[model samples]
Target: MRHITSALLLSGSLLSGSALAECQNTGNFQQWLNSFKHQATASGIPANLVNNALHNIQYDPSVIELDRSQNTVSQTFLQYAANKANSYRLTNGQRKMREDRPLFQRIERQFGVPAPVLTAYWALESDFGNVTGNVQTLRALATLAYDCRRGSFFHNELMHALRLIQRGDIKVPEMMGAWAGELGQLQFIPSSYNKHAVDYDGDGRRDLIHSRADALASAASLLRQYGWQSRQPWLVEVKVPVQMNWALARLGKKLPVAQWAKQGVTDVSGRPLRTSGNAALLLPMGRNGPAFLAYPNFDVMLRWNKSTVYSTSAAYLASRYAGAGQVRYGNAPIQVLSVAQVKQLQSKLRARGLRVTKIDGIIGEETRRAVRLVQQQMRLPADGYPDLTFFQKL
Candidate 1:
């Protein structure tokens, strides 16, 4: 939550023999188990698995704090990358790239998920092995499973954690991670590990904590499983022509790359559009700010987390490692406006009876087209640029 993608949230202290003994008091744990057994078993999670997990689980407060705190702290994409690209992160990324070249190469060879991308995750998620926290896995899962906001997801994942413990893959103490119940390096969720973790190190245990091979492989495997197209660019900064079509340059609606090219959109340097895949356009800061052309891989990252900022940040971070310079957008047709002005413009259109969705500050494609229609109706230029005058009319 602290700009960290995965949060492991195992107990800070490894359970001592005494604490283990306390939790293993069969009756107390059974009471906790009963609350979930009925629902989990009815959902087709085997009863044995449910008991196997619940019998060992406990509550972790750190995870709850992390979940709650995450919403309060938001960092812009540049700031996130810059903060993570500190000397520590870069040094670790470099060390991992060299020390684990074979492992990184394997991830690339197997999944076409490049090494830098995996390494970026390595540095970002866990500081390349320097700081995998010591949270108790079962405890973290149990806490999240009990939390109402994400009980169903955590409950299902908790069953998998129990399955791992029951199978003797990872014990309670070593199952450490960030604050959010993500496990090991490359910060996998329990279900993510259960499905794709590999014994790349072949050290008898697929230990994501210590093994670079296992972590990178698991990370790539997760991406591939989520439909990452091999060798496709995930994101590209583009130049919007002076009279860019406000409606088409929107993420809310699908537009063929060719159609966007037809509308005079080009790569940041004004090169002809080279991509063939269907893509969507997004302006997180409205029309006056940076614009992006997001491809299939962008959607794949969205599967990890849906916020436009997060996905774009990942794409940009990975691009930095890939030797691309920080992208600069063409001069914006309209000056950047604040959320208030943007919303006011939208409200005006709605007042004029446009089928606008809401007074949400974000002017998505529908809102853009709707604004353009209103502009044309007023005999204005109809370019769809938001300004104080646009709001004054309504």
Candidate 2:
């Protein structure tokens, strides 16, 4: 499986010679960029390709800013799904599916991945190829690699990008994409593109940038590689019995659909839901909010994006492509916490003797479980979701 990371570039405040010297006791970003040349050459990447891509590349301070601020965008599952799968996106996705019916069908037949799933990813990654980022891929990688926050990760990606250039998979000028060096219509990072991209059109090149067939096929290929089952539902919203085990609300704990149905779980309409495959109960908001039974394809989507919000959005969007309606967020109103506010909550949890070690402003499972503990102590719902009320008490 391929990995992804992000980075940044030069700043006026960081340009002071002494400050540059103090960064890892090596040198400034420019000096590090220059030094990377030798490493690239030694790694067997052609010196000419390296020079063409990195010779005059500048540090992008904006990349770092975007990377840090990305996590601050927190929203409830309903809100995120609504924004991602709006009527505009759904309409455009359906039109694209009709326009490219033959290609989508071919991809599905070959890869055993549904067309809607791939279409959802295509829409989400680059707005159906209408809004790819303008950052120079090499420079963004170099800036992030030099930043040292997640240096080794981005450094590896940067090297793979250079290899892609040397191998002539993509041209130097065409390597412009997201700030994190993601390329093409589906925005696969350099490493993921290298591993999963395919020449589906038989044009002798796996051109994810300009070739719709290649991009769509490549995305389907990725899901297939991750063990996607054909035509299986990724998720289905259900009405869960109030007296069921609350701990099963955590995502990814697989249980049979019949087993959950035995416990009074039913489809959105409260009718008995029958499914042959095992699924996981997922309560993104809380037990009091909407509930879903996520299948293996949902996990495959998670392999594409670690965020549950993103995976759920993709799943929901794909369902919409199948003519499914909007999600019903019954019960209490959804409340979300900003990354800064999450950090504050994490700090409070840390003080209360919870293992909240990296306060990276992301409310991951650890933070969520910690919230559950705090809620239990305070005699609250203990649903494991944070809100203004919970944070206010802290």
Candidate 3:
């Protein structure tokens, strides 16, 4: 298993300057990059390859901007859904699916990755290749690697990116992508490209850049590697009980389908819960919004992206395009709190020894479990919602 974590850059922003001073983009950026490049060459990378890559390298400010922006995105599922499933996007998605039928079909046959999943990822990541970002891969990866927080990881990623250029799979200038260095039709990071990409077109290259065959196949390979069950659906929209505890829904609490049926959870059409696998109760919106009983495949998407809303969107969109029925969200407004405040409350809870697992401000499984534990310890009812009352007490 490729034990993935956030790029080391995030660790730098954690403690302020930390160890980044060593690789910070001071005036010595070029010098350090040259030395870094030499070490890369000494480690079996070609010197000409390093010179060819470093010669055109320029610092990318946008990567830093996007790196910062990831933490501040809104929590509303609709906001995310509207952005992901917009009209222009849907139109373009259909067009791409039709135009690239043979390539997509070939990829699906080989990788067992459904076309809709590939289509969804394609449309979402780079807008079906229309809006692939134009950032230098070397600089983006190198700058991130040297950023002290996640330098080691990014440095390794930078090496893989340079290797792509060396292997002649993609031109250095054409290796553009998201600010984080994810490339081609599906937004795969450099490390992912090295690990999962395939030469589906048989052109003697794992050409994700200009070939839909390779890109879609590569995406499918990634999902399969991540344990996608081709025979299974991604997630099923479910009927949640009225007066159900919203806090409990977000905890990734798993119960048998029969147990859920006994408690009023049902299929989207109000049928009995299908007892095939243990389902996790998920509520992206608040108490009044739509709820889903997500299955194992849902966790697969989380492995790709840690965000709940992102994986939810991928599952929902994939199912939607795959002929799944639309779902109706009810009237619950998930509590709106800024990112910073969430962190503040979490830090306070940590100080009180409540075990708010990760320090990130988001109230994920760990934080909610910590909340429930604190509530029980305080001789209070253990609802896992973080409220102003909890903040004030902290």
Instruction: Return the top candidate by lDDT.
Output: 2
Query: Which rank order by lDDT, best down to worst?
Result: 2, 3, 1
Model 2 worst lDDT run, 10 consecutive residues:
9-18
Tell me the whole-model lDDT of each prediction, alpha carbons only: 0.66, 0.78, 0.69
For candidate 1, the TM-score is: 0.72
Is 1 or 3 the stronger prediction by lDDT?
3
Instruction: Give the TM-score of each candidate.
Output: 0.72, 0.87, 0.83
Identify the runs in model 1 with alpha carbons over 4 angstroms from their true place.
Answer: 1-30, 33-62, 72-95, 252-256, 329-394
Better structure of 2 and 3 per TM-score: 2
Q: Which residue pairs show backbone clashes in model 2? A: 7-144, 8-64, 9-60
Superposed on all Cα atoms, model 1 deviates from the true structure by an RMSD in Å of 8.3
Write down the worst ten-residue block by lDDT for model 1: 9-18
Model 3 off-target regions past 4 Å? 1-27, 56-72, 98-102, 243-252, 331-335, 338-344, 357-361, 374-394
Q: What is candidate 2's lDDT per residue for 1-394, written digit by digit as tens?
A: 1112211110001121112222332559878887889899998988887887887788888988765544422666777788889989999999999999999999999999887888998888888887667889998889889885667778888998988877678898898888877888988787778888899999888888999999999989888988899878897878877666666666747888898888788988888996768998888877767788999888888777766777788888998898777787855566767878987898999999997765756666677888888887887766677788889987
Global fold similarity of model 2 (TM-score): 0.87
